[model samples]
Target: IARIAWLSMGLPLEVAATTVDSQCGSSQQATSLGAAMVASGMEDVVMCCGVEMMTRVPLGSNMKDGVPMGESYMQHYQPTSQFMGAAMIAEEYQITRADVDAFGLKSQQNAIRAWEENRFEREIVPIEAPVLDDKGQPTGETRVIARDEGLRATTLESLAKLEPVPGQSIHTAGTSSQVSDGASVVI
Candidate 1:
């Protein structure tokens, strides 16, 4: 992402580039690092950018080699979860399934309204997204996507009807974070 932005913006190659990963906090970490550089007088201006192509990379790719839950850690701790951990936390906090679903419904509705009102027009950069057909094969066509692909027309009733993973509570696809593909840049 940094390289593409550098070349596209006609920046010289001498400028240094660094990428940081803090899982869900990656973009925030990038921005914080950039700010630290500027604040410490090590740099005048720094560009921070983040990109996650979930369609290509998907989730849990980093866990292919297994999570680094060492023997001592595993002995004391339950197996770590990704999304399920959040669901567990919500349940522990006594947050009901209906509450989560209602929040999801409100979020989707707000996102839809934002797009309809053109609130994202200024910040969104159009991307040439792959055009996939029914079988998930590329159709040799590309579409300029300016809005989020994961926003769905949802309602409280619809969200309420979805089931959580078997034996789990308070979490379903409708109440969970949607899979998304997106990139953003800042200077």
Candidate 2:
């Protein structure tokens, strides 16, 4: 997948591929590893990319073996611990449902404005997707998927209708980050 992304972006093969699995900190781990390798004179130039296409591979699917737990650990120890975005953010910031709703609304508005202004053109590489007619025949032309898939125009009233998440009862779908597909590369 890294190779495909690199080639698609016209990046060279001299770039190294490092995959990290630290849940939310996977990319950070990859970056630290890359830095260490360069500091040790293993390679001067490194390309690091972190991708979590939750749509393609849902979280916890890769952890079928289950997480470890024992009597030595308490409060934070569980056989299958998974942290959702809203829960973690709510716990960290003591954010309420109202605050989350407002943030979600702002994100949607900003993302829409950015899309309208083509603010992402420089970073985006348009890929051709097959265009099929109603009869399922392919039109010679292809559709461009240049924008993000998660942004949705929402209102506070609509957001308020959502049920609070379990445990803290602070997070809702509106307040949490969208389940999305994204890829980023650094030189």
Candidate 3:
């Protein structure tokens, strides 16, 4: 997929194949590592890519036993800290439902506009999936998927109506980032 993506984007082969992982900052770390490699005379050029198919892979599946080990460690090491998404973000930034909803709305609007402008075409490779009928028989044609699946036509009214997810006091599907499948590359 990376190879195809790079080729489609007209990027050079020297700017390919490198990988990095830094939890949520994998792409940033990839850029830093690439820059360091070039500065240290390791390579002439490097391509850093980050692809998180969060929708396909359940959260915590990559971690050992799907456990919140980091939370446990923090609880054991620092009793005062509560390690969870909503609590952490809310405590850190005093984030409210309004703030989160506003951010989500902005994100959705930007994504929609980008899609409309065809700004993503240069990097997106339309993937074809077999078309199936109601009974699951292949219709002999393919359906192209070119857009990000995370986007939804949303409104503040709809957002305001959503209840927070279980165990989260300030987060809902409307106010939190969507589970998405996409890849990105930097040269």
Candidate 4:
């Protein structure tokens, strides 16, 4: 997918492209690799890019066999639990549910405000997306999509109403991050 995306961008075929999966840090890792390439004089300039189409492949899809625990790993560590890890961190840091909810509220508010102020216009690359009919054939119509589709108008009260993850603390769908689809590129 990364190679295909590079070609689709009209880059020269000789330019190397590869995907790096570091979970949520994929893009940051890609950018770091690009910077290293430039610093090492491997290339004049390099593009750092990453993307996740969460709509097609949801989060944790790659963890079907669990997080690849080995005997050596188990000897030194317990398998990481996403929820418990977050809960423990929150507890250790003395962050309360209200604090989390407040932060989530701020995020929601800021996103909406940014959209209204056209702050995202500076970075968003508009795409011409086909309008499809019910049967899935294109209707020959197209729309320009320039903004994220994940932002929602949320309140503290609304966030508080969400249920926590079954086994551990504080995080709810409202307070946690959203699953989204997007591609980003940096040169």
Candidate 5:
């Protein structure tokens, strides 16, 4: 994917291109490596980019073939999902669901305000994203994606009503990691 992205952008073919897979921290790892290369005088410039189409490939899909949780891991965690881990952390910290809702509400409010204030205009790189059909195939067309489409209007009351993922004590859809699909490049 890294090589394809580089070639698609018409970058120099001789330049090294590689993919980094650190699970959730892949982007950060890639960015840090790129920065390190530049800082070490090994490269004058670097572009760190990543893409995740969750709709096309849902989370935990790769584990279907077999991603066994090691015994070492079970010794610390309950051998449950990350959502359960989040709930355990919440319990240990005494972070109430109300507290989570308040934080989520504030975040949504701030993001909505930022969009209204045009704070992201300068940083946004408009892209032509494909319009997928019901079967998930591209419709041979595209749509302009110029802003963050993830923002939602939410109130503390609304957020508080969301239930945690089944078997978890906290971390609801409103408070947990949200699904997103997109690619970003940082230079």
Candidate 6:
């Protein structure tokens, strides 16, 4: 995928490209490796990149879906999802549901405000996306997508009305982090 994406970008074919995987910190790890390579005079520049199509693959399913995790990893560590980790942190810090809800409401409000003021207008790079039909085929038309799609308008009342996540009581869907389809690069 890395090589394919590199070629898709019209980069020089001579530039080396490879994918790095370090679990959740893959991008950050790539950045570190790139920096080390440059510092060691191995490369003049490096494009550190990472991507996750969470809408299609979801999170924490790679191991179950056949992305090898040897027996030792299975015996020693179990995946504690981000939501579960957040709950643990809240429990440790004594953060209440009310506090979490307030924070979530503030974040949503800020996102809404940013969009309203067009603060992200310059930061976002518009890309042409195909207009898909009911069957998901391209309809011979395209649209420019230039803004964040995950922002929501939520109030304190709405957030409070939501139910807690399955096992954790400290954080609900509104308060916890969400998975999204995205890619990122640091050059």
> What is the number of backbone collisions in each predicted candidate, taken in the order shown?
0, 0, 0, 0, 0, 0
Between candidates 1 and 3, the one scoring higher on TM-score is 1
Q: How close is candidate 5 to the true structure, as a TM-score?
A: 0.80
* lDDT (10s digit) by residue, model 4, range 26-80: 8899999889989999889887878876645424543355446668899999877
Off by over 4 Å in 5: 59-80, 139-141
Compared with the true structure, the alpha-carbon lDDT of candidate 6 equals 0.80
lDDT digits (tens) for residues 1-187 of candidate 6: 7899999999899988989876567788889999999999999988998876664544444335553556788788886777788888988999999999998888888989989999977656788888889865899999987777778788889888999988878778787666665667778
- TM-score of every model? 0.80, 0.62, 0.68, 0.76, 0.80, 0.73
- lDDT per residue for candidate 3 within 1-187, as digits (tens), equals 5577767888777655644555557777778888898999988877787777664453533434643446768767643322264578787989887887888888899999999999988988888877779764799999888878778899988888998776776677786665555566677
Q: Model 4 Cα displacement at 75 (Å)? A: 8.8
lDDT of each: 0.79, 0.70, 0.72, 0.82, 0.80, 0.80
- lDDT per residue as tens, model 5, 26-109: 778899999999999999989898777666543554344543666788788666667777778889999988888888888888
Residue 52 Cα positional deviation in candidate 2, in Å, after optimal superposition: 1.5
Cα lDDT of model 2 overall?
A: 0.70
lDDT of 5: 0.80
For candidate 2, write residues 40-147 as lDDT tens digits. Answer: 999897777677666444443443453344456646654342435546766788877788788888888999999889898897876667777876478887888777
**RMSD in angstroms, all models?**
3.5, 6.1, 5.8, 4.2, 3.4, 3.9
Screening candidate 5 with a backbone cut-off below 3 angstroms (N, C-alpha, C), the clashing residue pairs are none
TM-score of candidate 4 versus the correct structure, residues matched by position = 0.76
Better of 2 and 6 by lDDT: 6
Error of 2 at 6 (Å): 7.3
lDDT of 1 by residue, 51-118 (tens): 76555543544234555767899989997566578777887888888888888888899989999999
User: Which ten residues in a row are the worst by lDDT in model 3?
Assistant: 55-64
- Ranking by lDDT, best first? 4, 5, 6, 1, 3, 2
